[model samples]
Target: MHGSFPRLDIGPLSEYREDHFMIARFSDYVHEHQSLVFPHRHSFYHLVLFTEGSGRHTIDFHHFQAEPDQIYFMIPGQVHTWDFEAGMEGYVVNFSDSFFTSFLLQPEYLDTFSFFDQDSSNNVLKISENVRERIGQLFEELLAQNARATHWRDDMVRVLLLQIFLIIEQSDAVDRRKSAAKGKNATVRNFIRLIDKHYDKVRLPGQYADMLNVTPNHLNALCKEHMGMQAGELIRNRIVLEAKRLLINLDLTVSEIAYRLNFNDNSYFTKFFRKETGMTPEDFRKSPAI
Candidate 1:
């Protein structure tokens, strides 16, 4: 039987302090973790722009060929693992949502980034060679500013990060336009955003339908059309994902995770976990591999 997936709480390579919001790297991270980066999910967002590489990147069980000038974005809870040849080079930026939301004037601005698409379908953006030079500079500055703390280092890095996002948005405008269904898919996007926000306390498709001001049937239809899954399935998937993250990374017990995720009883949570993952929570925790 298939078992549970384990999340690497500490980054496979490195991490800043818990309270700190972000970290960026150019080539050092890949060089340090020369071995396999175990299949793991992060609690923070991960953005990578590879300038040189040849191999594969596995995201949510899908293998994407590794290519230079390609960028990959992963939000929380998506499982990823990568393998590459000896001399791959890239820039990686890891951030917590609170990092920008707490400081930026527009707290909800992140929702507009096409790459962070909740369903993770368009997460990889292939960049052109012309734009690579400028993008690489942005990463350079972020690395320089983060190297040593000055009076305004954090603020400087924050501003630079915003610039990087804008550049990517501008560069990817054509791609977004190609698949853009702003009028129709907007509702589905809103539903996914809501699922990310409330999956723990609200799991019913009807609840999400009400939030979107559409009938449950309509909502399910839209989800199937856009995501190839029902709205309810997405909600349950999010909840189970968070549960798995907490179970594998934290010191919390099963009962504590059950309550944290709004399940009233441990038994029901166990049943739900088993139904979704094919293994009991205890068995999952004990497994040597994901």
Candidate 2:
């Protein structure tokens, strides 16, 4: 069985104070935190911009090829691991969930970025050649700002980081502006956030609709329009995703996972998993990590 990996906090991963923010060159970060090569979870926001590399990595079980100018984002609680060539180099940034809370009036501002949407499929982005250098430059500025304790150092760091995010969001090849506008819809965004918080206990779309002060049909229509799926599918997908994440940790038995997921019994959970993912929990656990 695969060994269970750790859920790392920012304090343990860096030599600096636990000031809720850390920045370093990718090579230095890797050298200092070699154990991160193993599958692990982070209790903070994590992002890496690969300036040069050739290998592969995983974000919440989704596989991605590591390449120069390719950047990936991981939110709190997502699992991540990387395997790269000897000459790999880049920048890595880790910040606590509250990193922007006090700085921004709207604490959920980061969620507006597609890359930070918590969907593994949207976690990675290709930095176009035009803005690649500028992105790297911003990262360099971040490294510098983090090293000094000058006046307003943290706010300067925040401004630079947001600059990098805005650049990526503006130039992303995916043409996310339209979808991003849709995502800003308070009802839809709130629905997704609710699902993330209560997926285990609240399993029904109708219940979520009730909480959101909307009808089930209206909620389903909104999800279908923006997320390309019905409301119920959104809930089920979150549950299946949690099952897969929990399955990666071999120490937990199927029954325990089922209980954690609010499933009544192991057999019922197996049936639901197979229906959604076409594999039993044990089967998924045994299969190779991709």
Candidate 3:
């Protein structure tokens, strides 16, 4: 889809481009501006805690129900939009990658949080009201520190932010364990990983099947069992997702995009895209995100 909202570099939060962190409550954000209706991408990571709300939040075109005590994290460059009921209450934390990467020798300092990875795209996590009490206190403290002018405000704020992340990590560990035990789709998972790494060069399901050491039929069966789709559909879906992203975010033409995505013939690319998405490349580029 095309961008209706102003991109971050041009939006009201453009000041953040020069700063490392900024925290705002939902009430103040709404009071300052009427609504955040436009779908936009940000230059920094976002941690939006929904303490009170009932509506929807869309990240990377994946829609999630907004409920009380739920938190949504957005990685940099991920596109999102929200439509929450009026009078909603929450806190929004914006920080740059540099903020967390300051003290790290290696990437593990921030990489430990896998949800922050763009691939997972940092979806929603529902927190219990009891846990929110503790976490909410920390946020309130952060808000308090954010408001008062102090010499060590930025450093102190960074410390508090890391604490919140640790809290989330501890609270979500059990959920991760349950997730690991549930579904158990290693084949599909590895297939997706491989697809991300090699989708540009490999188009055949047999190639992926060979890499995964399984017959194409077995791979298809596992994929259908977990994702409700077969091998070819998953690969095509990834290609279409990338195509849509490039078409929407870049100024490239259909032929350029086709070639950039490794299609040798533009017409064949259009037919393949049409067969998978029911729309030609031009039509799909003109369309909004589905």
Candidate 4:
């Protein structure tokens, strides 16, 4: 018999669990047909191991063809979707930020692994047969401990999860080195993170430079070197992207969105929006594609 797709809520880790980690092995009978794993954000991290079947998976804006022995690590708050065929078998592990902090705070761990990588979707780790066997063993052990209600089950699970993260970290390190040598620099990464955190509050290069503790000229130079765009252009692009997302996804009025984005006045916001986007926010919202 088939089982329902489990939501597996464990409540907050501060309540009962000593550490915020949960592991479960999925059987082939369970199929989430209509759910589509809708675009949503999470406060915890996810590590999905696809042991069998094929599908189309999208993380952030990039898409991938899913196959057996492929692993996807989705950080918190990233939008993702997956559609798998019937009889898919794998494991879905979720852990909170505090769970990782216990291990990630170590100097060696921080040096070896990047907590966030901008190109993670393009460089997913391919699990080998040996690694798959080890992971399966870990999952079985975790399930057994949970079933027996072991006194130290949470701690044991934390160790196992750390092992898995170490394996993942190795793969991420390889990808990171390649990306660092060929792609954006640390400044761009920081810039992107800042934008993600405060895009709705600030949209000026001077403001960003002040936050980064650098002169606007220096920030612009760094941006041009890594992203091949001026700092002001990047800020505008981010604002426009947020504006588009709001226009397409929410029922909020354009004026409300402009105010939410901290525009000084509605008229200026509309003018700026039209200058950055080819069409006005209203027209963009009414377009059939939206």
Candidate 5:
């Protein structure tokens, strides 16, 4: 609860400090990097596949119970921590944001996966028992390839990781395919990326619409159709989520947080937070995490 005003951004484990990629058994990773048990952020993309575990993990204040065959993906900069029973074992992979960009000509290729969309609720998935063994085999291959330095090692690792992503994507392909059929999947994803990049300064749907080269109404329609919410609501939700994340850092005063979020003043920020979450900033800060 108390440390830096902003949470710490942990780099790779000490053993692989200079490398931009790492793979390990979950138990080994946890044992080697105990600091992760505390509230912190990561500077690299992270994913974990659990073969055995019980308890829960929190990503950006959202709680998810730990379970076998359940996998989770996290992009850089999200807060994460976990509490699990003894004997938790699985596979974990950490790679730089550029891990796939250079390999694939399409820079946004990874974005097409719904789990990497920066929404905490969508980042966790349960693996159907049918494909569980295949997924485990892929992880085994990733681990083995990572251990060797012979012949295109990095490329081999990248391909294996993509295979894993493709398998998981198939599980949710129906919903994603439906969104793609709507013919606005790319546009909506762009809008979301823009919001993530500019939410602090841009507050209006019109601003985002202008950036996206579409009318505000068109933008709203796309969001409503694909995301089940108006464009403005999406922006507000991102802002509020950031607020909640910042409030978790006990070292930061409310006024400091307000400034960080670019609110005009402390009072206005409090009002905005209260309006969106139905709780004052202080109240939320003091509340116990689920």
Candidate 6:
């Protein structure tokens, strides 16, 4: 069991240089009582390598069981929470988005990797013992170089980081090829990715369809055919998922949450929420599963 921490806000990027990389071993302080890290979002990407313990990692509306020898990559701007049992060991590698775009953003390079694609649903990357040893060594080298102030230290750190991503790229190629062959249409996949990226602001199906250069009807038909649900259903699910997350994870009032979700009238939001969920917002918030 893990106790929740106060909501943590990781601030936006103040600098844009890709010269520095932050690597930390979380095992030093995270224990049973300290198992929960506050929900936070960062401007840079994070690669978390979990070596032991079991818990749930919640990112946006998605939740996954965390286990040993697993790697979780979180892109920029995704709010996430880490809940773990005692005695967890891991390396957290943090780098600016510019670092990736500068070095690995080529079409051929990106096409060779699946993990970086916004359309790919493969969030958790499993690591083999041999690969883990190699990654661990790279991380140690990064930490050592980052601690030094030599003129060539930054260059060395950047090179090492690139090497790490290159290795991941090779391993992720097979997965990407499989995903591409799955043959989901680009429009639907792009729409889903847009929703994941901008759902907080863009909630209307017509608006999304317009952005994708397709009619609302066509978009709805495609989603229903491929996902077994209409585009409207997908939008509503995202909204409700965010609502549930806010209600359960924060101390915000129902009315406040309704307003934040863009409901002009709090009562209307409550009614709509209950109509879909079969429970009032307040009652749903009080449920034990939360």
Best by lDDT: 2
Number of the top-ranking candidate, with TM-score as the measure = 2
Question: Of the pair 2 and 5, which is ahead by lDDT?
Answer: 2
Model 4 TM-score on a 0 to 1 scale: 0.67
Ranked candidates (TM-score, high to low): 2, 5, 1, 6, 3, 4
What tens-digit string does per-residue lDDT give for candidate 1 at 36-71? Answer: 365677777888888885887776645788888888
Could you give candidate 4's per-residue lDDT for residues 1-290 as a string of tens digits? 01221222223323323446766664422342245454344556766777878887766546778787787776655555566666677877666657656544552232234434434444366775656777667767766766666777767777776677666555433365444523336666667678777888877888888888889999899888766789888778777766665554444667788888889887888898889877788777565333
Residues 131-233 of candidate 6 have per-residue lDDT tens digits of 7778778878988988898988867877887677667655632365544532356777778767866776888899999999999999999888766789988
Poorly placed runs, candidate 4 (over 4 Å) = 1-19, 27-36, 106-115, 118-120, 128-152, 172-189, 223-256, 263-290
Q: Candidate 2 lDDT, tens digit per residue, 1-290?
A: 36634432334564332668998889888887776776777778889998886899998888999998889998888877788878889998988888898999998888888788667888888998889889888999998888898989999999999999888888844456544744558898999899999999999999999999999999999988777889999999999988888877766789999999999999999999999998888888778863
> Candidate 1, after superposition: displacement of residue 222 in Å?
6.4
Candidate 5: residue 277 Cα off by (Å): 0.3
TM-score of each model, in listed order: 0.70, 0.94, 0.69, 0.67, 0.92, 0.69
Please give the range of 10 consecutive residues that has the lowest summed lDDT in model 3.
174-183
Better of 2 and 4 by lDDT: 2
lDDT of candidates 1 onward, in order: 0.74, 0.84, 0.73, 0.63, 0.83, 0.68
lDDT of 3: 0.73
lDDT of 3 by residue, 42-81 (tens): 8788878888868877877677888878887776666777
**Backbone clash tally for model 6?**
0
